[model samples]
Target: MRIDLTSVFVDDQAKALDFYTDVLGFEKKNDVPVGDARWLTVVSPEAPEGPELLLEPSGHPAVGPYKEALVADGIPAAAFSVDDVHAEYERLRAHGVRFTQPPIDAGSVTTAVLDDTCGNLIQIMRVA
Candidate 1:
């Protein structure tokens, strides 16, 4: 099966939407309410608009643990491929993005990590 979607847990959906759209430049794909929360998704301009990142809630018990563990470890953010890591990094920084890790050579790929200002870090990467 093709990898059409991935998820990033957020404390709030509305806040996450602003960051993803306003800061990251990802267009909103859909916002479907599924019970107490919503099934929010966004897609990059480069992508076919089919694959989107599911912005799920961290309030649920099942995902709360997983989300906390990842955030606590200070691991890299959800990796997103960019045409030019350096350029993209600069663009984001100019937009007042707070970066925890600057763009650096990662052997095969150059990557950078930044806080989404919501709850989790976000990663931007490019092929080396």
Candidate 2:
């Protein structure tokens, strides 16, 4: 089966959508309601109509524990494969994004870590 969807635990759905779609250059794939929260998803412009990143609702009873666990353990941000780690990192940094770790070479790939400001460390990777 083809991998088409993934979820990112977010504190606020609308804000997350704005950041991911407006800031990170992603396009909205879904914006329908699914019970209490809406089914919002975003896709990379480079991979339009490809895999989607779901902005999952946090503060929910079931996912609250997991989200808290990840945040407490300092392992929250989700990663995304990038075409150019340095360029993307620079562009994001220019947009006032805080990066805990700068771009560094990791043999086969170059990687960088940025703070999503939403209780996570988002990693961007690119093949070297």
Candidate 3:
């Protein structure tokens, strides 16, 4: 068994694309129109054929409250692996991205949390 795709609910697909691609460094994979929302997805530039991250719309009834609760509790909706958490965090902060939590060492791993601007908190991490 293997994972092919996963999703993060987003309030705005356009903004999500910009952040995920321009800021977070993911590459756009697929973008097909599906009614009011497009079937948007992104893949890591290092792994173009790997699992895709779907930017799903938050139009569903339960999505808003679920996202709100997650944010209220300071939880990240998704996590991306980086070679250096501190470097990535600094680079992102230089780009005007807002981080909810600064990079902190956690045993063999280090992580930082940032607001995705599309109504979700995302974590960037690295492992030692």
TM-score of each: 0.87, 0.87, 0.98
In model 1, pairs of residues that clash are none
- What is the alpha-carbon lDDT for the whole of candidate 3? 0.97
Better model by TM-score: candidate 2 vs candidate 3 = 3
lDDT of 1 by residue, 1-128 (tens): 89888998888999999999998989999899899999999998677457889888888677766656766887754888888988988999999999888989979989889988767877888885
Quote the positional error of residue 128 for candidate 3 in Å: 1.7
lDDT of 3 by residue, 1-128 (tens): 99999999999999999999999989999999999899999999999999999999999999999999999999999999999999998999999999999999989999999999999999999988
Question: lDDT of each model, Cα atoms only?
Answer: 0.85, 0.82, 0.97
Clashes of each: 0, 0, 0
Sorted by TM-score (best first), the order is 3, 1, 2
- By TM-score, how accurate is candidate 2? 0.87
Please give the lDDT score at residue 112 for candidate 2.
84
